[model samples]
Target: MRKIWDIHGGIHPEENKHQSTGTAIGSIPLPPEIILPLNQHIGAPAEACVSVGDKVLKGQLVAKAQGLFSAGIHASTSGEVIAIEDRVVTHPSGMSAQCIIIKPDGEDRWTQLDACEDYAQLDHDRLVQKIRAAGIVGMGGAGFPTAIKVNPKSNKHVKTLIFNGTECEPYITADDMLMRERADDIVKGVQLIARFMGEVEETLIGIEDNKPEAIAAMQKAAEGTDIEVVVFPTKYPSGGEKQLIQILTGKEVPSGGLPADIGIVVQNVGTALAAYRAVRFGEPLISRVTTVVGETLTTQRNIDVLIGTPLSFVLEQHGFKAEKKQRLIIGGPMMGFAANDFDVPVVKTTNCILAPTQKELPLAPPAQACIRCGMCAEACPASLLPQQLFWYSQAEDHDRLKAHNLFDCIECGACSYVCPSNIPLVQYYRASKGAIKIANAEREKSDKARVRFEFRQERIAKAEAEKEAKRLARKKAAEEAKKLLAEKADSPAAANEKTTSKPGAAAAKPQAADPATQKAKLERALSSAQSRVERAQKALNDEQEEADEARLDSLRARLKQAELKASEAQAKLDEFGKAPEVTVGGEQAIKDKMAMSPRDKLEKNLASLNKRLSTAQERLAEAQANGAATVDALKMGVEKLQQKVNDAEQELAQLGPDSAAQGAAETAPALSAAEQAIEKAKAKAAAQASMSEEEKAAAKLEALKARLEKARARLTKAEEEQDENIDAFRAGVEKLEQKLTELSN
Candidate 1:
């Protein structure tokens, strides 16, 4: 039994093709001006080789190819480029791209160019270069760079060349007519490609049976060349490159990969004609055959149009008929965009300007929910689960939609056509895909900011804590050292009394008693001082190390900060000690804890106390500083010092200080000058307390201004990228102002 295969596809959408293909080819007169878009292919836009004031000739290379993947632009007729700026393009985005506006002289003069013979003699790389320079791109719907299709340096296994003469698309017969008229040129172009493939195995030209005339013409054209022209059964999208390749070679291209991966290369019939021009005439691809067909047009012809010609002009030339008009489609009604505006340009891939009226092709009604009917699934050529994707996409469940292979759906509009629900399936899929992309971008940016900000804040906090611990240990060592010295000096005074007792003086007492007391005190004092120094050593070891690079760098920064702070703190400390107490009649100096934050005011007081202690130690430098003052002097100053210290200690204890007290003492040098007062505060503490409220308010204002400035800058950047956030900016500012007012109140 012979095997029969039929791939899943849509119902027969109305062709309405008779209006254009029924008539023979007719000539279109040149317009006064022809607009040329710099980009007509699916790669980098061509760079303008001709300036605004420069003149050009018919079929002259006007724009240089931009990149290896880019196509070149040319002048279709001798003209002057009056402007090079944004003009409408037949882009799915419906947005304008850069274009060159030409005012043609209508004489259509040909530029002097080098036409080559024996193209096989040229280097393969050079051939590809010429093709790229000539601006030849895939003319079959997709305007991919044609040079890219042939140069499969990456994949050397492609052994077969397939020529596509299968114009299976409904209502468009441009390729069919071209094959009928230029079959010999098309075959010659194929041989030129065969020159590169080098002794190619077998060349195959596939056409659908519906185009018997094209197949007959190609059969004669390829008569003795070993190129086999086969006719396959008629089918929609048989003209599709991958689809036609499968029908001819029985090869199914793996998803997301190309035909080259499977040892095959496909070229369209019209593309072959362009190749012949590139090789034989040295002419670039500047014009294309546009099928003007529909009930709306007064006259329909396969007009050769210059690229970037406005759709409006094309429609006007034929006389627009609005009678019973429903929609204006750019390509065939099966898979094409309905024209929202008439300013779109004719690009390299534009095959037809299909204007089927309501009577010709009626618009469907409002979409109804899917009833789980599988007509859409059956119609899907890629074998996707359309209904499943539709469900997730409508619910905005992006992950599920992707998991169901939504990307594979090709937006052919077939699923919607057979859909009993009349669902606009493609629209939902497009919206979901766009939303998913935008969401991913936002998430990535947010994650990056969070990581950087958190790490910075953590580093700052850890550094401050490490510096504080070292300072406390140093202060404790100083206090203990002072106590040991006092104890050493006081022992001498007591020992003297023991030696002078009258009853036992004669027998027990000796002149050595004073020296013995002095020795005991010296020994004890030396031991205590050594212990103090040892403790300091242990603390210094634990505080920070030179080996931990990050920690060391942080400490060096903190030390500089501490040094800066010490200068300011010393000044205030000196002032406090020097200023005499004011004589208010029987009123003790009141330092109410509530009047100011312990963190600042307390630091000022602590600095003053430390300064007093430092000054007292200087006088006793010979004893405490040098460990050698006389016993009596050491005892006198220390005994009195301990009593005054006890009273000052009592005041600190009564403050009921918490962790803030240690922090206050820590901030003695780090703290800046005391703030004066808050503009508004509670009456009881208003006079003494100072607040950073005014400065904070000013800072907030500046921050808002900076945010606005940055938003403006971001908006400018967004405009360049074709993604603006002006509405988002305005909404956020409104929310910010509301929050600020609530906080202020």
Candidate 2:
């Protein structure tokens, strides 16, 4: 015999088990309609797999498990899906949740199933998958998915397996009846779970002294095996996972820790039988043995009720006297809550449908204030300070509640049962636990968002730094180029080359230097100014956040200055292009050319022709030697050069000395005439430059009139020809007219 230990605090409520244990487990008639809530477990809700108007067979998957922590839901009988909407569910808050409603067709037909003759041939993971596919959960009312509980982390080695047959709650005998009837199946399930646990050291079934028949049946089934049936004194709430572990192994599970953390696992006997049927017979958890008891019902016994059967239907089957009913509860009287509506359906976690008359179970009076009594603390199975937790809960001090380890409370109603003032201590604890869970979830979400925001800010800062570095590099390169250009422009060699490359080099030297060089410098200034304008504009546009007003104003001002500079540079370049070129001392150059004699001019011409002929001959010879593509053109040029040389020599030979002098004297007259015209144009430009304001305005008006007339004529011609540039011509005419009017004003 294995010795059993005791927990910290417990209460022995009135044993009401005999009321439902008199008869064998019976089945209720098929309900006309069933209501299956999507969420029947502790985690995420299941997702619906069927739609309304779809025909489904018994044990068919109507909703799938949403995640690893949730359980699947199936049809309890062959039926047609009537509705898929929110309906009142078996929740503590009496709220509505998404559910699947079905109308049975009276035939309990089943779908195809995948059963394994021998579970030992499969691996541990395969067995767990089978259990998961069957939608089995902790049938002891916690409704935690069994698959998740059975599969612990690889590092934690399970040494003991405990089957909880201690149905210590008042007016609930579902597990007790199940143990008495399905002992062999329960033992087989224990063995299968032990094999899945990988070499568990010991297997023990913990039952109370009140269930002698269940204990003897379990012992007989567990005989000739390592499994042991351990019986202990009857106490309320000893079936809690933590308390049971303590009773069986004398090792208390750590606060806020699971039973697996201590190398032990406890499961209800009903859950074990469900696993056995799921793996061996391929039957999903479509129904459960629910104890339908209380004085309001004439027939009080355990019944195999289908999941999703309405509470009203179960009551009707038991000949319920609604007039005598005081309150309708779902679980045992100690831990169960009053049902707000009779339409709420049964779920996997439901173990009993308790309906008692007012004389049998009366409602508690209004709760009174606490007296700081230590009885609640003494009766607390978790050994927590209940009075202090209650005070903090009333104050809504979540921090204080956490410090008192409020999550360790099992909500078994022991504290409330022993309270002198009937404070409903368990209700306060439950509400506090929910608030803490929500607060923790919100905190985790806020932390993640903050991390993401910080990362985004860092990325933007890095990009801005890189952009600023590139801008600085470009600015330095532009400055260096400007410096090199200035140095080249100011060199003595540049001035000398500019002077010698123009016509009448000696006379033009006294005028301004080359306009091309100045224009190039102005163009560089314009480019730099434009670049600054673009950078400033980009800076303004990229400022997305609340920036300093002074900085924004400064950027705008810089952009305006850059634009002004760029416009000034562009105007200077345009003025430079429109300016006419002037040659000074033209008369002296004409006189020097006219002074040459005819014989001298002929000889000069002959020498120029001879020089050209020699150059052409050299190019022709080079082209022939290198096989150049321009060989034919070069040969033709050489022939032309020889002919010109012959003509020049013949002309030079025929000219006499006196004839050369006379020819030079006659050319002087024509040269004198051209110089007079050049002088007249220079005088006119000088007079215009020195004109007063009134005179200048009159001259500009006259010029505008003449331009307008010419533009109008061109516009008329373009219109006649239907030219594409007619609009441009018309625009030019309008501008000239506007200018003429402005100058006149």
For each candidate in turn, give its C-alpha RMSD to the true structure in angstroms: 19.8, 15.6
Model 2 clash tally, residue pairs? 1
Poorly placed runs, candidate 1 (over 4 Å)? 1-5, 198-200, 432-745
TM-score of 1: 0.59
- Using lDDT as the measure, which candidate wins? 2
Model 2 C-alpha lDDT versus the unseen true structure? 0.86
Q: List the residue pairs that clash in candidate 1.
A: none
What tens digits encode model 1's per-residue C-alpha lDDT throughout 1-745? Answer: 1122455574565555567766666556676567777778776788888789889998788788878778888788887888888876776667787888888887889888668876767888888777877888888787889888878765466688988887666788888778877799999888877665655576788887877778889989999887888787776666676676667767777776778888888888888888888988788887888788888888877878877677887888888886656888888877677887787777789988888778777888888877997888888777788888888987999889777877666667778778888898888888788898798989999999899779767865765575566556555655666676668657877679766778744564233323334444444444444443444333334446424766555554444333333323433344444665444431333333334454445466666566655664564564555664132343334444554665466666676756865666554543222332332234425533443777666666667766666556655655664433456765666666665566556
lDDT of 2 by residue, 164-202 (tens): 898889999998899899999999998888888888999
- Please, what is the whole-model Cα lDDT of each candidate in the order they appear? 0.71, 0.86
Model 1 lDDT, residue 316, Cα: 82
Q: Lowest-scoring 10 consecutive residues by lDDT in candidate 2?
A: 505-514
- Tell how far residue 224 is off in model 2, in angstroms: 1.3
